[model samples]
Target chain A: MTTSNLHAEIARAIQAAPLLSPIANQLLQVTARADHEMKEVIDLVKCDSLLTARLLRVVNSSAMGLVHQISSVDHAVSYLGERLVVGIAIAECTNEFLGKPLDGYEGESGQLWRHELFTAIASRAVARHARAPLPADLAFTAGLLHDIGKAILSEFLRGTSRELVADIVRGDTADYLTGEQERVGLDHAEVGFELARHWKLPEALAQVIRHHHHPETAEAELRPLIYAVHLGDILAMMGGQGTGSDSMKYHLRQEYAEHFTMSKDDLALLLLECSEEFRKVEASLASLKET
Target chain B: MSQMVLGIGDLGASNHPDAEIKTYALGSCIAVVLLDPQTRTVGMVHIALPESKINLVKAKEKPGYFADTGLPLLLQEMARHGCQPKGKGLIIKLAGGAAIMDHNDTFNIGKRNLLAIKKILWSYGLGPRSEDVGGTFSRTVSVSVRTGEVILSSPGRPNWKI
Candidate 1:
């Protein structure tokens, strides 16, 4: 197909896919505003029974390690706070889109979601360590959606292009994102940005999805946030969290490592916490499967 | 067959013939495998970095995170598992240690890891029987205790015996 035709086809595929649930989109908007009222969040969450049930289930679940049962959305918000609760709500809402395999990336079923979850958890840890301007939950959200483009781009890379990408990435000096652009006319980061725009997500979130692979190229104000996601991505890869065939093919930004002074003990502790969070997320997911 | 997975900064050994010990998603990290043909024993260590001087506490706590410390710990565990540490029955295979990010050789942790492993092994007068190291691919490595077979696989690439 011609380059324009391929681009059009990719755009159509992105539109056809289930981008994000209405509740998740609303949560995204509410979470963007620092002064968002708790009552507004409670009211919005109450409108979706699935979101409410999942939130209550999560807070009461051993993942939260809370002995008291959160019987209502109000109690959940009060106990877990608004940002974390919204992060989980987003996880629940977007599970369908995030929880699948990307053949182009060579991940098994649900591997992408696992990777995203790890990145989100690790991103929060990096943000706190770096003292980034963005809130922990926002960093988590940005990390979770950093690879949404791979999901969209995978469809367009079904045939010979997949091999082309794999070969180029495996070469001595080729970067994965550049290889993607060369073969498919656009990279996953850029495609992911377009998807975020299509879903009407906040501008900061969209910019994050675009520049995560190349944080230095991002706006100065968003550099710390982008670096958090970038470092989190590397940490996830190092830990082998939900990685696929293309696990280590991406660029590693050592500049981020230089900016932060992380001891081995600190890294070990952060990863331990991330592993705990991963197990909790897995437990909740298992329960979701049961129901 | 049962499979035992070794995470980063982890080392494990087993004598069960039905067991297959594996480590997955190895980028710059290295998986060092030691197999004993006579006892059907297998040991593997997934080491992340080169040396332990940078983090003494972590190296003390989890020696498997570095080549200098992890390799010795793996060997000790192998000997404890009733395997001949220096006999002909011992077969060593190494996989992973790839420079996934090719921007420059400055932060080539994979190359540094390989060099460390070589230096440490040379001190013991031992070396790997087979290796699939370097390049820019992430690898999953497995060793079959029953047959002492070491296999390596990566995304979009063929799985082959090392």
Candidate 2:
């Protein structure tokens, strides 16, 4: 689609996608305190049984590589500390809120999860070098749930026309995004931004989802956060885990680093740090398997 | 299938059964299961996130992300061809789940994926003889049970043996 058409469609999708309804009460009360404290957040998380169990399972899982047994939420929180602890809690919370698969991509089932994790990693790395106010955990949650709109409209789009989606899979953006815009009148980014606003996530994060691919227009206040998260996604896509069935069409823009005011050295450091961090996190995760 | 590069949502196994089943660029997404000793059964699913205990409907929609829903289904599918979950030892080797999100911190998916698999294994109490998982660079993984090799290749050259 033309740039103007693309912009309009994305704007429309933002209108239709699933997000917290202002009328609805908070989905769940959360008391996640910053400054890396754990007990307070644990108390809030413990109130939710499913979250509690999942958190415990996550704590005990061999994937983490931590042999320590964390019996209580408080203990689990303390053991992992705030950054990692909050990240895990956010992962648990995210699964509940994020809807089904998106219509455009062939996620099959778990594609969103994969995308989220990678996004989180990418954001943390980008923000570290950029030194933006955005917290790694906040970006992680934002990145994890960015493409949520895709799931909400997957069935509708599937029924709308399989051929259009086939074209998107084939990287015919003009047709795919345009078709999506015509049908839903908005793209996934707009929809996701709305969801973020409704969720009361950091405004910057919401904007990141809204303008991640094209942060030039994001609100000035939210620009840096959006840029960091955007670059994170781009990096993950570059890493090539899964940019959906239509990845070939979207190439990474080198200007993102400059937009975020990151130096080449900074970008190199981000990648270098990410690589080292990937190993550490991977090792920690490996140990967390269910025993 | 094509040996070139099987991007996400695309599964490709080497046409030759004797040949290896290789897929690169795996991070948090699963490399699925690749079994060769018996019949040519290699499943690779690129699950983006983790399970949604709170959202069962979403879970139903995304069995690949959640260990609770995805593993049993995958195992059952493999079982259709006499590869029962409990009976035979399928030398399963897993990789990916490198938390690119947090460098100072680590997300639970890499851990969760591992845990989910372990729980499935616990039901049957099965574990891979060994594995090479969790790194920053996207992994170039190859699993050939027939040859008993699960090689992982990162972006830079000099991939390691499993």
Candidate 3:
């Protein structure tokens, strides 16, 4: 396929792809609100049976180590509190979409999901450490969805472009993003950005998906959000949680420290903290496993 | 065949002919493979940092997390497995230690890790026979006890024996 045709085809696929279910989207929006009450969140969750089931299963999972079983969404919310419950809900809601492997990226079954979960977990910690101005929920959302395009574009790769991607994944080349752009006419970041737009996600979130690999190109106001997810992706990879094929080709912006007003010492500490956070997230993800 | 995976802060050595040891996603970390060509025993360590001076407690607990501590411990295990000394049928191969594109040179842990491994190995009068180190790529290193051969793989590259 020609460059434009391939881009167009990928765009069509993103539109048809599984999206954040409406209830999940509402739950995320509600969780993002500072004024949201525990009762309000509980009521919102109770309306969706699937979400409620997922929440209870996770809260009661061995990872939580709760002595008591969570019988309902209300019990889960009260026991685990708001943010933890919301994080679980997000994972449950997007489980289907993010769960599949991106063969083009060399991810085996569930590899992409695990990789995104780590990124989401690390993104929140990174945002907190960097003191980003946006709501931490937004950081988590961006991080989780950052690589959604890989799934969409997996089917579109072909010919020499496919070879370049293979080479990039193998570490034969130092630039996967650039190599994709040069050979395939677009990269996953750009595809993810368009995907987010198609879903009508927040403008900032779309920009983040686009500029994550190149935070320097994002608008000044969105840099922190972009940087948080950017650094989170880097931290996840360096922590050895990379998905497949494209684990270590991207760059880590040095100016991120200056931009976020953090020192090198602070960055290192954040990584240590993120690694700890990653383990917790990994354990919690057990809830997503087949029962 | 028995295959063992070495995590980020792990080390293992094997003398069994059917054993194959491996480690993956070695970013900014170093993977050292030591082998006894004659005995066909193999030792591998995945070292995540250059030194243990900063986190002595962690280093003490997981000696495989740093080149300074892990390299020596890995060599000791090789000896326990009946590996010959320095140039007498002993082979060392190195892989991993890749800095990202935008990371400042000062914080290049990959470079630091390679240097630390070199320093420690030099202290013991040993150096790598072949290396696939540096660059902005994560690699997986594997060694087979039967053949005493080391293979290195990166994201999109073919597995090349070192």
Model 2 quality (TM-score): 0.53
lDDT scores for all predictions? 0.78, 0.54, 0.75
Point to the candidate with the largest TM-score. 3
Model 3 chain B is weakest, by summed lDDT over 10 consecutive residues, at B81-90
| Reproduced native contacts, each prediction | 0.43, 0.06, 0.46
lDDT per residue for candidate 3 within A1-291, as digits (tens), equals 688887777778888887777776776667655566778888988898877777777777787777877796778878766656666665665676677766666666777776777787778777876654656667877788788777777666533434775566576755777776776688889888888877767677788889999898999988988888998788777666777666767878776775565554454455555665666657766766767
Give candidate 1 regions above 4 Å deviation: A37-43, A63-68, A72-75, A78-84, A160-162, A165-173, A254-276, B7-11, B48-77, B85-89, B99-126
The alpha-carbon lDDT assigned to residue A166 of candidate 2 equals 49
Place model 1 in a CAPRI quality band: acceptable
Alpha carbon deviation, residue A202, candidate 1 (Å): 0.6
iRMSD values, candidates in order: 4.2, 12.7, 2.8
Model 3: residues with Cα > 4 Å off, grouped in runs: A32-43, A65-84, A131-134, A158-162, A165-174, A261-269, B83-89
Model 2, B20-104: lDDT tens digits are 5666666555565545456555544444344445346645665654556665666665666556555365656677655442332
Residue A125 error, candidate 2, Å:
1.5
Q: Roughly what TM-score does model 1 have, to 2 decimal places?
A: 0.84
Model 1 error, position A193 (Å): 1.3
